[model samples]
Target: MKKIMLIATLLSILVEGYAQEKCDTVFVRASTENGIIEGFEKAGVRIFRGIPYAQPPVGELRWREPQPVKNWGGVKKTVQFGPRAMQLPVFSDMRFRSNGMSEDCLYLNVWTPSKNYREKLPVLVYFYGGGFIAGDGSEYRYDGESMARQGIIAVTINYRLGIFGFFSHPELTRESPHRASGNYGLLDQAAALQWVKRNIARFGGDPGKITIGGESAGSFSVSAQMASPLSRHLIAGAIGESGSLLGFREMLSLAEAENRGLLFQKAVGAGNLNDLRTLPADRLLKMTQRKDVPSFGVIVDGYFFPEKPETIFSKGKQAHVPLLVGWNSMEGHYKALLGNEEVTVENYEKAVRQRYPDIAEGLLKVYKANSDEEVAQVATDLAGDMFIGYGTWNWSDIHAQTGDKKVYRYYFVHPRPGYKNAKTGDDPLIKGAVHSAEIEYVLGNLPVNDVYDWQSEDYFVSTLSQLFFAHFIKKGNPNGFGVPVWLPVRPNQPADVMIIGSNTRLQKEQHRDRYLYLRNVHF
Candidate 1:
């Protein structure tokens, strides 16, 4: 009887302990000033997917500032991804895939690891990149699980894309308080950040420690946000890859965006905003293919984006914060698809001479090569330099020269062995260390496990990189375990930069002469 009683007690204790072990999932109720939203949890991380930061920009709300979501009665299921913003057909192999996308896709996703009533982890809010036309956060690649696992609450967001997201018209302006228009996508991003500031704490995220980052157009949005005083307190720092806030004056101010909207109206033959809203989401997405104009992006609106990004940064009015910036070796590695027969040495020299009359000779001398492929690679490198590299240096230079903030720059040259196309031979014919390649590494998604497997190198690179980033987010300096004593980028120490690659070495005076030559070139 005694033995039986003890066994029974043990069984009961085990059962109770099992019962007490709550599923790692967390749930939170977001109390925005607009309404209350209930978000579920996944493995101790609270996730709110497709939560509307603003009113559905449907019907008369289209092309207008994002309004607050109306109050809800009970818990709203945020399991599935929200509709994607209007976008052009992104995939090239369209023959195999249908463009099943939509326009009413202004939504955001958040992931946090804490469930305590008061614990607030730092937030990492991201914007996806697609040249203002293609990407959405729904890609299988950008899952924030690893980032959240590292204790940084992660948020991935989708904003308006293409013409639907960017179109600005005279009539549209007349309807606005700022009397200016363009870049509804930027406004959408801002709305999402505002939502983070208001409700992130409920998910155990520190609103004050939020870091804004993105790839291409997403990077442009970061620059725009940096320039906007409205977004000052919402973001702490920024990370931009292969995109900068230098050009777009002509594109943003042009009537192309408005014209594209007019085209959408003509396609549906919608009489007004209400009519446009009534059109089916599918039809709107299909109509987004009308023409590739300056349809989406932040404009030089005197209201939100009062001045050009370069002008803003030049005056040192950009958000005073630390930054981490980098670019791939071959940003235009996709040029093979362009099949340019003019990618010859003489042609490139002539082209450089014409485009950069002031420093063409210098550029040609540095990138002088023997073959078309080499010249093509040089051209891609030069383009990357002009678009991303120079901007990165200038950004670091500006901050180091003015603000008390720190700036860290990197060059991602870790080209995986098997990553080279088998058909391309010793030369990297495809996008070698191309744009967005650093993403997989930084996320630790590679599958190599041994010395022979290239993944070991990738693993170390990613681990150290993650540590650097995490350290920066947590304590402002990107120096900690496994990172080679990273120093601040100052005018006196501008030469030192963290080179993230196979060896992960620290170098000085890297790309100085290259960027110096590009300084005189026109965009």
Candidate 2:
């Protein structure tokens, strides 16, 4: 009888301990292709952070393509963010809650509002933009919790950056089974998408309904991924915010890229690929910061790109999925026009004539400015084109003309409310939406960034934009109930992009002549 009483007492202790533990923490879980991962719950969302999507690219793997993640035996606790890719903190606005930086950074995070494995939500995987030099998926401005609440699964991923990601070398290419060296970053992105395809279904994400989107380099990456044969089947639709390697930038050939790699090796006094690979990751990161360092950005590596990006797009060889792309109003500010010259009609004209000496007369027709005010406006417009407008426009135009599906284009014109310049200590009287200003708003994350004195109007703008984007993710079209009617860019009618700003409407594309001039005559 005493022994039976003791057993009852032990059972009571076990029950009490279990109750206490359950109250202390809540655990949510997902079974991935690699392993079961446990996450924590917050705000009606189950968030899994720092899930490794690729084998760490260290030692002999630095310049190689990303390999598959290894299967784990037990449930991996993915409650904390992983180390960010090796990079310098270039943007003051970028913040992180990750452990720190390292080369083992091919990690992706997810946010899901699914109650069980039976629910399948549309997935939106966003890549951060940082000129391919620096960025973290853990930035507060890109939090996916709110997006999950909207009944969509959100994902953010990290890839190798800068030289560590884009470097090309003759020795490295020879060592590659695919005879490719550069574009490791692009390959990393493709691997991440492949991971999404094979593993996201377990997290209540629809593997067939994944939409890839980003701003700046991330936009460039989306374009690259769409162009690459490796990532074609993984994408359902695409959203490019404001840049592509082919849109406004030059891409080095494999040979040129290898030469640049050679120059970097010479400057750094590395004898060979073996020597370079042995150097500390920080050492390589520091070399990328040098102004004189040859930057071999996106290249036509034989493995990643079967052909040039433009050639692929021109022949309708890219992914035939629906595309939604756009840029800000003032992609390049007035300062980009003035440069060293004073803001005068005479100086502006002189600069224009110098830039377009061969066609100065014809160029002035499109960029006509008789007064100083007119000059600033014209200069601002041209600078915007030179920065990102023309390239993004070129992408949308080509895709609309060639792709199997219709294309949706937009021009974001909402300027950030003028606030005291954080650096100058006075209001700069900001008047235009410069590059990357729409990211937070479109992602439904305006509250995450308080750098500007956002008004109710700003929130209104955010709500409408997010709705449009969410609709696009859920359905192929951004048009839906209670939003402004949006029409696709027709094959014949090139203009008619949706204008999203203080007053949202469908405005006919105005500077058609100027864009044509820039496309054909100017640059």
Candidate 3:
């Protein structure tokens, strides 16, 4: 009887402990339109990583718009980051925490502040930039935790890349219900937006207050979304950094895109769509390295865009949402514009004249050099304009003109600290905000990347910058009582912009004439 009593008591204690633990620890769960998902909690934020927003585009689905993800019967655990889109390590700066690389990379990560699934917060959906060739949402620099802490729901997403994402051919176009090919990457973005609309409310985000943002190719994508009829209605606001389609390259027509795809087929010795589809992902990715593989850029597929983006903007048919857009201080390096020649006044003038023969005098006047010493400064401006400046500035110009909604412009001028190691690449950096330098600051992620020695000024900049972003996200305007006063681009007056740096302040657009001249000159 004593032994039986002791054994029964032990069993009772064990059962009580298990029941107590089960009651004490509450797991976070949220239901989507498709199914229920389980996410982890960290530092007061509920994180759902690697949630499938669409089906993996493999085999027959290659080069097609993302398909809907299949619903699961049980709660899906979203723990690990999905594989990065198929890509080569083209950039040295890229560092990822994802599982690896694969064609099955259509995933998105969400960071939300609400512990319960009932609080509807504003949503910020960010896209990673890689010239549309490479980039992943799992990059440490773009982590959404910081933004989530600021009372907003932040999400980062992955889309297809390189040949698998953008390839176009006659056979592929013929099979499409829309009679279009290419731009599957952009279509993936639209599809993701649709998914968010259907499911974000379940994740504690308001469907109406969504802002789409990105840098470089991602920035160009925001502009593309604004022009795309399928996506424009989904966009409530926009944020573009460093690039847009309107500046330099024009969109390729569907037929032109298909012709390039045909060339790709001939170069790869593939006869038809079936032959290309049967090729392994590795084989298709390897072809991207060859010179004969025609480069695929954003094209005017009739489904994505009714016409060219430029034409859409000109006619004021693009999305009439409030826009916060700008580029960095140095989008292009001096060497790119100077070529083999030194930064001499004579060389600078010659280069300008050669490039803009018809508008040399106007170009020279806008990009004026006071002395030989000032050549670098003038050249930097000229070079940046040539690369991403003209396009970005042109975008703000058109939006401010026709959108009627407030447009806030900015110039990211703060450069990163000089590297501690002379061997590191960012040490010999120019005295301007290098391309993508503002990312860490904007996302409040200075601590994650130890590439450079961060200073107090960096933190100060980040605090202000993120506040501006958060403010804009919470409310359409980026200004409030506590935040620095940010004014919109004044109509008919000189275009004004907030200089986001150590000393954050509002200022009028500098060298507006130069951008204007380049706009016409490029035309």
Candidate 4:
């Protein structure tokens, strides 16, 4: 009898423990402006995935501004990621955790450390980079849980891509009350910002303390957002990495965008706007893959952009928020300059002369290479400057000269470690940090990406980098305890940039001559 009683007591205790565990891990619910959403909590952080910020942009609503999500009754489950934007597999590095591709991809994910609405935390909204053609918020490199762990509310949102997002026609302009066309993707971002301002408080995020950040094209979007009146008031700070809209690329005029749209309609045999609207999204997407099809790009619509981004920044009419921006060491490879030629000084000189015949001597003087071995690094610097570095520098310089807020600059130089279990010659030797390499480190998502054989040094760099980002998001300054001092860029002074690497420290700008020369030649 005693043995049976003991066995029964053990069974009861196990059952009670299991029940308690289940209760502790119950799904969390938050009320949004549209409706209540149910999301699961893990490791003390609440995660809400695929929460619709806008109505499905399908059928007639295609190529239009994002519409407000209609209110729904009952609790809606948002545990799974929504579909990614419509795009081709243009980049190999992107790995998605989304449902699928679709035009109805205006959703966002949120990660918060707050237990209740009263615990209002600073928020960071990150935009993914794919040159405005391909990217998704569901990419693992952009997971927000790590930032959430640092007492922040992190958000990742999806905007339309390629033709689905940027298609512009005369009819579109006629229909728009703002008398604009194109830039629908940017408009989607603005809509998402408005959504956050209206609803983030319910998720325990302070609506007034939101920071926007991105890399590459997303970084360009940051500059565009700052310049535009729509989203300027919505952001408290901005973080741009490796690119900007200032002078990197020319924004197409609405008339040029409409001409491209007309060409597309002719290519697709669409009779009119109605026919284009009825065309299947997959068919439209496949047509974009044609070589002759002009790439859909951002436009200087009178709505999202009243004028050129450069004009806005020059006039000091952009957002006056604290700006933290930088670029990588090797944004472009030497091969871009040398093409198929061998890495020789003669070949490097010939390539520079061919590209900039009138000013090759001045460029050669600025980007000097004495020996054959030195040609690769020198060519890489020049190529990187022409590619994106010069534009990023121009943005920082212009903002410092115009804006009232503090500007912090950096040059990320930490090369990612090699892959695990890789054969010899499988991975090319990386000389410096390539473009987009800083995303994982700055977001504290190194562990989320398992492809790299991360070392203790990588983790240390990630920790330090994320600390700077978190501090900036919280207080509009990257400086904090336990990190090296980062000075803000002063107008008309020699800029001090934080060199982020194994031995991260502040360094004087050594290549201003290169950037200035490129600016004079290109602009």
Candidate 5:
């Protein structure tokens, strides 16, 4: 009888533990100011979704900065993803699956590795890329489980995008403390990071060891955060992929960005901000599809950000932190589709003269192509180099020159698994590691049906790359178990940029010589 009682007690305790473990599998509710948030967990990760970081930016809050998340009552359901921010239709059936769109979209997602409730692991927060208009953290590709399993607490957030995220008008500016105009999305990012600082510890994450990272627009945000006083002390290090400090011109201020917004309003026949706001959510989304211009994205408000990110860094006004930055070798996949009909010598020369008049003559000599296709490739590669590669290189160069913190650079050259099916528009030839191609490698969650082969060189490169990133997040150095020695970048001596590929090698002139002609043009 005694033995049976002991066995019964043990069984009961095991059953209770199992039930507690299953909490992560089902809809787990979390309490927040806005309400109860429910989230799902899997593979040793606790994922909370659709949790409000701030009050819904609706009605009076439109075009205004994100407001504080008000207090909530009972356990909130965060299991389902919240509505996506207003965006144009890229996917056809984008309803609840992609369809449900809302202006009240200020929610964020969090992924914690374990429920130990005391681990306090380093936190890595990601911002998605959409040219400041087209991305969400909830995208399936951005699921942070893989990253979280690597022992870092990962969080992906949704900020306002397009006009919803970046609308700036004179009226909106007058009501501000900074008198700042534009960059409300940035404000949202700051708010999310602040939320992480305040609450991540509850999820077994260290607020002090937080690292901010992103690709493209997200990378742009990382650069901006490095310079913003409002963002100081919120971040430790950074991992920027394919975007850099040199791209500040891409960010516009309230007046400038809103002028474009006004133009868009006129084109769309909306008289003023109120009308623009009142337009049906679908219409607003449709307007974003116009491709003419959109009223969104980060801007260079003197208050929130500077006219030049480099200028701030040079003046020692930027945050002093280690940086890991890189860009893809074939970044022209999208742009080449739009331009470059034929890669003929004449066409290439003409294209160069038009796009880069100052360096056309010089670039023509270095990038000689007998066939139109080759010329197109050269031009596309050059564009990739200028926009993505240049920014990355310059960020490392400039940072190495000033701060004591180490800087590292990389060039992503891993090919995807199935390139044949993924052809786009005019440029149909296999796009050797294209822009945004490295996303899967970084996140370790490539879509099974993705065009490029993940099992090829990308598999090797990505493993190392992600491991390096994990190391950087945990410790300051990017080296870890069985990894190759990553060289630190210095201002002098070719910068020792790490070429992340199947076969990693250090190359001094990864694309430097090709871009030499543009030196006088001032990148």
Candidate 6:
């Protein structure tokens, strides 16, 4: 009788423990304008993935502006990521955790630290960069969990890509209620912003405190958004890692975009927009891969962009939000300038003269190379400037001059350590921080990226960089306790750029002459 009672008591204790554990499990939920969504809580952060912000752009909706998401009846399971946007594998660095690839890809993911909507934390909406042709919100480097941990509501959104997002036709323009075609990808982003403004408060985000940020083409989108009348009022601040729409590439007029669309239609043997819409998504994507197909890109539609982005910024008509913008140390390489030739001074001069014959003398003077060793570094600088550095600098200069907001510029120079599991001689020497290298560091996601053998300094840099960004997102200024004092760019003054590396410090801008010279010369 005694043994039986003891065993029964032990079983009762076990059952009670299991029940208590079950009761402790928290299921986080939030109510949006559409409906209530249940998100999973992990390590105190509530994550909602693959929430549709707009209707799927499919069938007749192909090549059209994204439609509003309709209200659903039941509690939709937003646990898994939605399908990524339609894109070919153009970049090797891109890694997606999305459910799959499809045309129905207008979804977004959110990570919030607040337990209730009353917290009203600041929000960071980041757009991925794949030259505006490739990229997904589900990329590991773009994960918002870490940023959320820092008392932010971090969001990543997917917009259309390549032909699916940028194709424009006269038919499309005629059909549009706004009489605008092309820039559907940008339009998708704007729609997502609208959705967030209306619904983010439910997720514990302050709609009035939203900061838009991105890198490369994503950075271009930020500039475009600031200049667009539709999205400028919706953002409190802007962060651009590199590149801008102002000068990275020329924005096409509607006529040019329509002509390109016509060429694409002819190339695919589609007689009209109706036939183009009827084709399968896979076939349409494959057709875009052909060598003769004119690459679809952003257009200056009168709706999204009333005037050129440069003109808007010049006229101080863009969103005068606090701006944080910079580029990496090496956005391009000497190989881009030398091609197959060795990095020799003579070859460098010849290449410069060949590429810029009209301004060769002035260019060589600005990007001077005296010796072979000097040629490699000088050529690298010139190549980087020609590719993106000059444009980024031009953006900062123009914004500082015309806008009333403060501009904080940075120069990321911390190169990644090396691969952890590399063999004796397999690791290549990284010259400098390359383009898109600062994403993980600035997002506090160095640990999420397992490819690099991250060092203590890397973690230090990551923490420091994220702190700067977090402070910027929170208060529109990156200066805070425990971080280096970063000065802002003053109008018509020598701008001080924060050189971020093992020894992060402020340095006066040294390449203004180079950019000024490039600014005058047409390429």
**Model 3 — TM-score against the truth?**
0.92
lDDT of 5 by residue, 1-523 (tens): 9999999999999999999887636554444434556677676678887778899888778777788888877777776677778876554311232225688888788888767657889989998887776778777667788888899888988888777777776656777777866778888999998888888877788888999999888888888888888895688899888887564145565578757766788788877777876787677777766767554666677777755677787776777888888888887642452363554667667777787676677767766566766765676677776667666666766777775689887888876555555644433654577767778787776643254435555567778878889999998778879678888886655667677778877766545665444444554
- lDDT of each model, Cα atoms only? 0.69, 0.86, 0.87, 0.91, 0.74, 0.90
Overall local distance difference test of candidate 1 = 0.69
Residue 330 alpha-carbon offset, candidate 6, angstroms: 0.8
lDDT of 2 by residue, 1-523 (tens): 9999999999999999999876866789999988899998875799999999999999999999999999999999999998889888888878787769999999999999988866778999999999998898898878898788778899999999988899999999999999988998889889999999888888888999999999999999988998899997798999999987665477788989999999999988989999999999998888877877787678988789989887888899999988988999888755665676777888887887777688777767887888776666688777888777888887888888877887899999998765435542432423677788899889999887767777899999998999888889988889897689998988756578889998999988887777676667524
* Clash totals for all candidate models: 4, 0, 1, 0, 27, 0
lDDT of 3 by residue, 1-523 (tens): 9999999999999999999866665457788777888877776898888899999999889887788999889899886899999998899999999989999999999999887768889999999999888999999889999999999999999998878788889998899988988998898889888888888988889999899999999999999999989999887899998989888786789999999999999999988889999999988899889986788878888888889898898888999999999999888776776787977899889888887687789878888988888888788887888889889988998888888789999999998886656544642425789889999898888988888788999999988888888888888888875568998987666887899998889988868777777777777
Instruction: Tell me the lDDT of candidate 3.
Output: 0.87
Order the candidate numbers by lDDT, best to worst: 4, 6, 3, 2, 5, 1
Q: What TM-score does candidate 6 reach?
A: 0.94
Q: What count of clashes does model 3 give?
A: 1
Between the candidate structures 1 and 6, which one is better when assessed by TM-score?
Answer: 6
Off by over 4 Å in 3: 1-27, 354-361, 420-430
**What is the total number of backbone clashes in candidate 5?**
27
TM-score, one value per model: 0.82, 0.92, 0.92, 0.94, 0.85, 0.94
The number of the candidate with the highest lDDT is: 4
Better of 3 and 4 by TM-score: 4
Candidate numbers, best TM-score first, in rank order: 4, 6, 3, 2, 5, 1
User: Model 6 segments beyond 4 Å from truth?
Assistant: 1-26, 423-430
TM-score of model 1 (CA atoms): 0.82
Superposed by TM-score, candidate 3 places the C-alpha of residue 473 at a distance from the truth, in angstroms, of: 0.6
Task: Give candidate 4's TM-score.
Answer: 0.94
